[model samples]
Target: MTHRLALLLLLIWSTPLRAAQEDPASAALAAMHQLEAATVALEEAESARDRVRAYTNTIRAYETGLAAMREGLRRAATREVELTRRLSAQEGELAQLLGVLLTIETAPTPVLMLHPTGALGSARSGMMLADVTPELQARAAAMRQNLEEVQTLRLLQKNAVRTLNDAMASMQQARAGLSMAIADRTGLPSRFTEDPVRTAILIASTETLAGFASGLSEIASGDIAGMMASISDQKGSIDLPVQGAVLHGAGKADAAGIARDGILVATRPRALVTAPTAATIRYLGPLLDLGNVVILEPQPDTLFVLSGLAEVFGKVGEVVPAGTPIGLMGGEAPQIGAFLSLSGEGNGPERSETLYIEVREGDSPVDPETWFRTDKDG
Candidate 1:
């Protein structure tokens, strides 16, 4: 048992340590530090010259930090289980080692050295004990290290509850600040204002998404200005307006067998949706069966239709900059206890909201995936 345990301990101890994956407790600690910075930034957002931009950035930071914390916690939990399983496997051998330590600790040195086989036997036993004593000590020390780590991980997880709660509270504050800032924001140029009467008439006349999109070109009440920067060079590299997984690509049929000319993205609840490029807001509001729609005219003829927003920002005619906050995906934010439960059970955030995206170039449906970067992310 001692030989086997010693070999196992040596194998584990000699394995080269790589820093590719950071220590879990350290990662969680780093995430806590990041959350603290985000909280500080949120406090300063009210006085920022561009409050909208400041709040937007702060919210993004919180989202990132929280995600990191989730990841770090998951890793810690997994590693803790692994260390525990290994230590438990050697419990029997360790119990015997505990007995040896206690024997020497309680008995005098002379009594421990005496052997039933007399002087030479005692000498041989002493030498053998000396050799194995260091191995036993090393095994106990290895077990101690693992025990300490498991205890540390358990304590970190226990304390993570407060950290997560505080981070979530600060995120809510950031979101509120962002909403207020957007309300006070101004100075965005308008290409053409929406004529209420014409838009109303068009909405009543059109039953399909394609027809409504086609009618937008003729419904604007004012003169259309020159187009924004051409994104023709940026094909296949534009960032997705929101962080999500593409549920259905263009023309992909749903369970009902109805295929749409857009991609459906599955996003986590209340995830921020930003403008992918510098574009003029053509229209925003509920339309037909779509819950909420925001149409963007990036160029003269090209339009990007984003549907299913809980709350849309910016006016129909205002030209917003790229990466500006446009809207938020719907669904209630998870409560702290529920979030912790999810962190314990899930691999990542639960995507409970869906966003519909369609791209039209000169009244013709085009593949949005061709223009936007769809690379995988954590």
Candidate 2:
């Protein structure tokens, strides 16, 4: 029993080892290494006394690796089981052939047949049957061929399964290691607390993305600019039926700002959406971080993006004079559009209605600060 147990273990271990030599197994191993690396990085990040953002990112990486490992493992297991069943069936057929051979050798022949063209067609018919008949030989050959096919399939399956299993195990190990590292680094549960600020930030960010998307839709609909001008002229603001902060700093985005007062105000000439139609009522809902965004086409060529307001005034195609009340910041703590300029490269050119608000005088980039004056309260 001990020997059997030992052999079984050896077999199991060697099976994976042999499988690792196969192409699929090798690929699986490679993937497993990637998973391990990701997991390790996650752990290291967690361990290094870093910010909550860093730790959260590490955790996310571990999860992604874990997911990939699981998917690979599932595929491997399915293939392995399918191949194993086929192998078993082939083995059974071989065994039946052996049984037939044994019966032919043990049983006696009841009668002999003669051919018209020969004195004796066959002398050792029973003997020939016992050893191997043409039919039985063909069957045996077919069985052998099937066995070979099954074995080859089994080999491939084994390799694939081993590769996947190893990768999964490695990933799991890495994840555990990273978790340990994070725990050691953060002394964690201490890190766990009510993050109301983060929650609010996320909610605000999501709203912003949504608003941007909506504005893009309006742009695509070709009504954004017109609507903004109309909103600026008539209503004090175009409410998205939503309430949130507009954290505008100009250039490309990297962070968000919170409002402490009732609303954040855009004191200067904020870039508004450019459009052709007059008044497009594309409503933005409540709780959008974009606060309020309205598009306005000052001229046929120039477009503006205005945010941080509740209601805006201006009409589409209506040549409004400078210093119109496009809208006012309506958040807890409203802010101003401090500066605006061209978007630096790497933030690909705006493809949607989302405009990268830039101020230019002909070919030269102009600072929006120089053009739009700040309101007294702004």
Candidate 3:
């Protein structure tokens, strides 16, 4: 009994340590480390940290950390449920085994060795038990391992909510800082001066998205001397403007049976949207049925139209570099209960807000998947 107990303890200690190392919780810890590092650096820099670039990175760190934690918690919960199911399925066998082990534990070694039969029969029975020792040890080790894992995963989830709350607070601060920084931004070269009268006239006259897009150049005060470098070579390599799930591909119909020329991405509440490359903003305002739109002219006769933003940033003629924050998707952040309940079903991307993306060349709308790097590329 003593030897078996020692073996069980040894296996439990070794296996859980290794399992904990490779578990989903490690990802959350890694992300938390990154967030802590970014925030610490931002604090140490003080004045230097109050820039769009710094704030963007900090916001990203917070998002990554929070997402990792949420995913970890969900996976932990699922794993715990599975382990419990497995243990329950084997409950009867486990109970009988435990009873036998307990009986053996309480008995003296001399009595256990003695049997009702003669000495030869007793020796034979002891040899049979000896033959089965390894199997019993293995079963005990497996049960112990499962029990320990369930305990560990539960502890990870129990502590994660508080950490997530703190991270969410820091993320909001980063976003606010970025908003203020964008408001105070300067020195970005302009491709052309904006003509509000022509823009307003175009808006009032246009009835369709194509019509508005075709006449967007009229809002500019004539063509500027220089344009940003052509991005023709970078097609299919551009980063996605926002982190979200793709609800529908270009030309893919929704449940309502309506199809559009652009891809629909469902973003999280208040998710950041950015420019995929260097481009001149040609138009940024409400247009037709779409919400706030930011039109970018990356080259001659080419347009990248991003719509459905809660708030637009920059003027109509400013040139924004790659990955510059352009706008934000609208919606309120989730409460703790709602967040845990809604997030991490392993279903798909967060769908709190939706962004519509369209890429037009010459005069016709094309598939956005042709231009952006997607998960499929991986």
Candidate 4:
């Protein structure tokens, strides 16, 4: 009874140990399956709304699954080392057992039965042989299990690499499609014309972002007080000009380590930049330290400045409706570098660009986060 109880306890403990060893790989596989499902959903989505939802889900799932994969790979590496050591030990034990078996088989019948210490020595030798046999069998079984585990781990690692490649490709395709959609939708007419003389002056005289912003504020004449008042009333409920992730919030340092007074959004190449609210294009020109910039006046004292455009659509003094396209993000399609640097996952060699936005009330910068709809809000 006591021997049976001891065996039962050993079985329970060993079962749990094996289960714990397998848990990480199992969990990682589950996460990868979830990510695959999300990517499929993204690929199958027909509408913009559905695509956006699926894309968000895919991003989240990919991140989660990637983390799990990394952890599982680390654990597998550790397990491989342990298995190698155990297999070596088991091989040594098996060799010793074989040597003993050979000795017993080759010995004469009388010699096997006889002992130096008479009958007591013979009985002790028989008991030791009985004990060693079961241990040898257990070691063989354990070695086999370890070999199987190592094979499984190698297969998992290979699958993970393939899945990661597929995921990155899908992300790139989705971003490109999104950029095309935005460009197609941003075909609004310019209500005003470009002022080349003023543009040149703004380009030459504006030494800093603040100076450029001040110049833009003075360029346009105020019009339609009622519309401006209505826009001001909806201060905190406005949508951003471009649809993408916020790379840097207001007052955050940019890649150049300069603290910006506005928000920086990382979006797909050639993404359409639009007017957040009903505003007139106060200034449209390239200034020092900023790319092609577009300034809009929603009211007499309120100005919205957008910079880093590849192409400007609106002209100076153009009165654009809310959600009107003003320009496009500066970059060619199929950009092979970091699309969104905020997440820090560069998504292969395709790099996305940034659109900088600043809202000013008579030269004082306002936090765009309070006004613009963020990813959380979307």
Q: Note the Cα lDDT for every prediction shown.
A: 0.81, 0.37, 0.75, 0.62
Task: Give the TM-scores of the predictions, in the order they appear.
Answer: 0.87, 0.26, 0.88, 0.46
Clashing pairs in 3: none
lDDT (Cα, tens digit) per residue for candidate 1, span 12-44: 222212211579877766666667666767776
Please, what are the lDDT tens digits per residue for candidate 2 over residues 126-181?
Answer: 45654657788788877666556545544544454444454444434543443444
Give me the displacement of residue 15 in model 1, in angstroms. Answer: 27
Candidate rank order under lDDT = 1, 3, 4, 2
Q: Which 10-residue window of candidate 2 scores lowest in summed lDDT? A: 334-343
9-88, model 3: which lDDT tens digit per residue? 23322332344455666654454454455455344323553377656655655555555556656666678789999999
Off by over 4 Å in 1: 1-20, 104-107, 111-127, 255-257
lDDT of 4 by residue, 172-287 (tens): 56545544544444443444455566656766876787787777534434432233244667877787787567888998888889888999888656566677888877777677
Q: State each model's C-alpha RMSD to the native.
A: 9.7, 22.5, 9.0, 13.2
RMSD of candidate 1 to true structure, Å: 9.7
lDDT for predicted candidate 4 compared with the true structure: 0.62
